[model samples]
Target: MDLYVADRSFNKLGTVNNRTSLRWVRRYRKTGEFEIHCPATSQNIEKLQRGNVIIKPGDPEAGYISYRNLQEDNDGKELLVVKGQFLTGYLNRRIIWGTEIINGLVEVAMRTLVTKNAISPTNAERIITGLSLGTLMNYTETADYQTSYANLTDELENLSNLSEIGFRVRYDGSTKSMQFETYKGLDRTAGQSVNPRCIFSKDYNNVEKQEFTESDSSFRNVCLVGGIGEGADRKLTTVGSATGLDRFEVFSDQKSLSNVVDSVTLTDAQYQALLQGKGSEVLTQNKKICVFDSSIDKNANRKYKEDYDLGDIVTNINNKWGVRLDTRIEEIEEVYEDGNEKINVVFGDEAPTLIDKIKQLRKG
Candidate 1:
């Protein structure tokens, strides 16, 4: 492998081509690209030895203590000599989101949680984000009027200053409804810090305009929404459905008979994107789920996204009949480890901030 030039010096340049090979240099003779032929066979690229260390700016001047240590010469070694393809295995074998340990624990818990006498919903919520936890949701809404709007505006501003909170919108989209929500932080602990229980995502759309959406539409009105949160309360629950929607259900298809979601389907690209983006990836969508968030494209075939709203973050997205337009957002937290101690802090969901966006939407 040839040495790339960031400057005349051979330092600062990272190694490429061979994943296992390491590189080091003592001095730069001039200010130009340096060809690094193999030390053994001048034609072959030179490789650094495993465990070799390099000295940087400050140190005992020599040896591999820290890169910061300055040296009359440079030093470093390859730690791992992984041979063969860089990729280890297929999706089926992947652990995902550092959740190898997490999955095992979750599986055991779920078996116990799903007991015959358990209080699980008949119609379950499927997370559009396909989130297990640590997901931020952005939602939109309108206030009653007047003083309420002003109050909400102030609250939103105040909430923004709080270290725990996060945001994306400054009053755009949803001529009638407004957008607001929370962000899921970089990791799970950050998610738990929100001290949250429910996402409380609600939207209003025209009653008509229905077509294919979700992985399968025959399921019709039935769609995968969100699962229950940790701190869900029984009292003061806003969902006052005189009709029967007490239990959450899952299904393979929209068929009235098809209930109980057995498995979820996602593309390799989508899956990798999520894994790489740290679960903060775009919402998984089919025609059945309508989304609003950055513009949306089913297959890059329909790439024309209008000044989209929160609905754009959705997939197979439809709105409740009586409501007008609105955009949404999510609540997220901060996560970082402290000297062997883990820390998590929640933010957003400030009732105060909700009042401000309500006021903004009410404005012309």
Candidate 2:
């Protein structure tokens, strides 16, 4: 496949055909990345612009320019390499809320980021008109983010994960517009085609390898939530019983997770919703799966597919390995080199908690 190089201003730099390697990774609730490598020939070296951007102009979906990398091979031959994240990378350049509630924060942050001079200037406009209220709905308790500082990308991603909602960053070449969406998991009943019982084995010949892993390092049965009000009105509520102490001991303390809003009032329902969501999130992040598929080359995989994506729920039924799992595709890693391509997919569970935070605090 042919490739084109460009600058940040959308100016055409040059073209390269001797592609030695390429990788495009898509992740769930995380930033995905892409990488391209080509021979360092003088002709190609000229294409290695300082502010590199790779584009597959002729191919609509793959034509988006979104990487910057350049290097020399071991043999002293120069190479034009492009590597980085998609539009989501722009979110990493800025920090998000540290003292605001999360209910309407997403809309506000996105509105600011899409401005022409706000973050990264793009030719596309925001096409998303709304977000899934179920995914972003903060019912019970409001948060007063204290001391924590996080990038816009991460803060947004964490919000999605905490709410058990689906989040996506998509580019539409047809309209030349970018879209940010938050919704519930894929609806298999959309009347199209969703086979939750899909099998991947020698009979299918689509899967090359698969691995399953389960761990309890993050099984927190109990959750402690502290409310924001001042010294006299503040309160701490503990959820979950000590019933599973014999089986395993998993304790979660979130007393300082949020500070109360003196002016705004929160209802009992919202508090329960936040507490339930946090507990479920922790319970689901302790399992994982890895799947490998090498049938398609990297260039051919640039386009999107309907059957699977960053957050689609799929089932892997392997009788040989006694594996039957209904999980979500949390991350995807694609590697293309020397005309061969391999796709590594990670499935199951959300992300783990920050254990280091507790350790450091205790040491202090």
Candidate 3:
């Protein structure tokens, strides 16, 4: 695999070898990352910048992971450890502006939101640049909202969740523009016909490591959604659920209700959307089904681009272990060293975030 460095002007600076390792991670509905380790002298250190582009050729799955953070070890010889975040890191530099979007299509809403990101929220004097949105997918629902100071990633995800769709932010290594899309949206092509069961095997030669865990640590069924502020005006919408009530009671407090127009000024539809999104988020958390990490070369020759990827549903049945799992690909981590590649694939129910864990703990 070859790594290239380019300046902000998209001009090729140079390339370097003497590499140690290259690692890239892909996450569902969240930002992913990549890292490159190389031993370089002090003279070549100037080429690595915050916003500069780092391209890794030969892999379609980890198309373009950009540099986010950098570390260095220079005792006798300079060893540069370049850490990077996925394309979604672009949202870190963009913030949502307050705009009342009523009865707006999700595509339009996304486009509208991107337009607001034209100016940098932090640097009022300078404009935010280098954003090129792809074809926004059409969804069924008409999104409505009264926005506030929200991060661009959160804004996109919330809108996506409300619309009952998945969102992914990607950087086009070829186009040199930021890209956004709904999971399984038109931007993505249909997956291949390769059988998932045959794609991942547990044979001694194919499998290196495998593990599974089931936890109720982040389970939530009943969601008592409370809108902004206090008092009777601060209405509470409850998503009644009876599952797992006898084993343990799970509850969630949705502090941000989009439909409540009293204090947050969100319309009823908006509130319902938030309520629905939160409800789905909670209901899916009842059980952490199956977490599988397998290293296999079964489908290494098959097309992995649009075929097997994060968010694709796959069925796995291991009769010996009495494990039958039909789960989505949550995270795909790849490690390359010494001219050999080992891809670690994680399949499970929706992975919870730190906030999700805290919310579950608070209920207890």
Candidate 4:
């Protein structure tokens, strides 16, 4: 894959050549990232600088250059390494300034969050030029969201995962603008007959290598949400119905969500429903994780981008292990090295990393 460099203004600088290796990663519910290693030539060094943009042909998202590292081997051969996240990462730089409540469609709520904080914000100084919301997909799924002074990316990812919808910020080179939109992947699992099914298995010679993980070490099925008030007066709600040995209970503090929203007081029933919704959202973040990691064979029956892409629900079967999973493609990593390319796909919810744990703690 060829890589091109662009300025912050979206002006094409030039193409990058003689690159040693590249790792381009894309995700369904979160911003993607990329890393590049190239010889420390004058042109390469000049092109791969911090604050510049990296573009890949046919890729929906463009990367933002934020880091650079220069290294020299024993033979005195210098190498320049650069890394950054996709255009969607721009949201990470901003936060929800104040309390924002949504009690309707999930798509509208996401758009509102971006608009109120990034695009055309109430504070004109905070507005991000050239950034706009794309046409809504008009999904009917509804949700109740209330956040104050929270990370925009985290909130969006939470909503996306809860609704099984994907969000992206794509750069339009011709228009020189960025568009944010929500999307849902096609159901290509065996249970769905409307679309052609995509299955990866050793029997089919499509999976070059595979690793499956099923763990409940960090799982919590039941969440007892404690809302405003103290002791017995505290509004309480529970999510999940698992009982006996299968039940794992956890507490979620939701004191910030009040009965009043935008100066309008909700009835007791409405407030109770809101608390329940928040409990459900909390449970989603602390549920069991079953992940399937696999390397796909290029010459396999199903193609990469053409057949199945990120966010699509696909099937993975291992008769020997008695495993059959139909899960969404959560992430795809493209590695290009030594003039060859390899693709790695992750299905289902991935285990949280150190950074993820930090974010969760911060939210708490």
TM for every model, in the order presented, reads: 0.16, 0.67, 0.74, 0.97
lDDT accuracy of residue 146 in candidate 4: 78
- lDDT by residue (1-364, candidate 3, tens digit) is 6677776544667764666788888776566788877766553467665666666665332223344334545556556767777656666666665543435676577666765574334445434455555666666666544455666676665565455455555556676555556664222212435343324446324455667676666555566666555787775666655654534444455555344343555556566665554554455455545577666563454334454676666655455788766666667888888878878878765456687566444432
Off by over 4 Å in 3: 58-77, 99-111, 118-127, 139-147, 158-166, 173-175, 185-199, 203-206, 228-234, 243-289, 298-303, 350-364
TM-score of 4: 0.97
lDDT of each candidate versus the true structure: 0.21, 0.50, 0.58, 0.89
Task: Please write out the lDDT profile of model 1 over residues 1-364, one tens digit for every residue.
Answer: 2222111111333333322222221111000111111222211223232212222222111111111111222344322221110000011111111111111122222221221111222333311111121223432221111111122223222222322233221111123111222332232121234322112112322111232212233112222322122334211112111235533222211111111213544443333322322111111111133222221222232221222121122222333433222212221111112212111111112122354335433421
Q: Give the Cα-based TM-score of candidate 3 against the true structure.
A: 0.74
lDDT of 3: 0.58
RMSD (Cα, Å) for all candidates, in order, is: 24.1, 6.9, 5.2, 1.2
Top model number, TM-score: 4
Better model by TM-score, 3 or 4?
A: 4
- Tally clashes: model 2: 8
Q: Per-residue CA lDDT of candidate 4, range 1-364, in tens?
A: 6788999888988978799899999999999999999999899888888999999998889998999999998999998999999999999888999988778888899999999999988889887778999988999888876788999999999889678889999989889789998888899998889999999999999999999999888888898988888988998888788879999988888887788878898887778777877877877877688989999998889999888999999999988989999999999999999988899999999887888878877766
- So what's the TM-score on candidate 1? 0.16
lDDT of 4 at 191: 85
lDDT of 2 by residue, 1-364 (tens): 6666665444567776678887777766766777778776777766665445556544212323344546666887766766666655555555543333434344443333333222343432422222111123323322222223445565565455544454554444444444555544453322336443333344455566666665555455555544445566655455555564533333344455453444565566555454444443343332232343323222332232544555666556567767666666667776767876677777665335476335323311
Cα deviation in Å at residue 313, candidate 4?
0.2
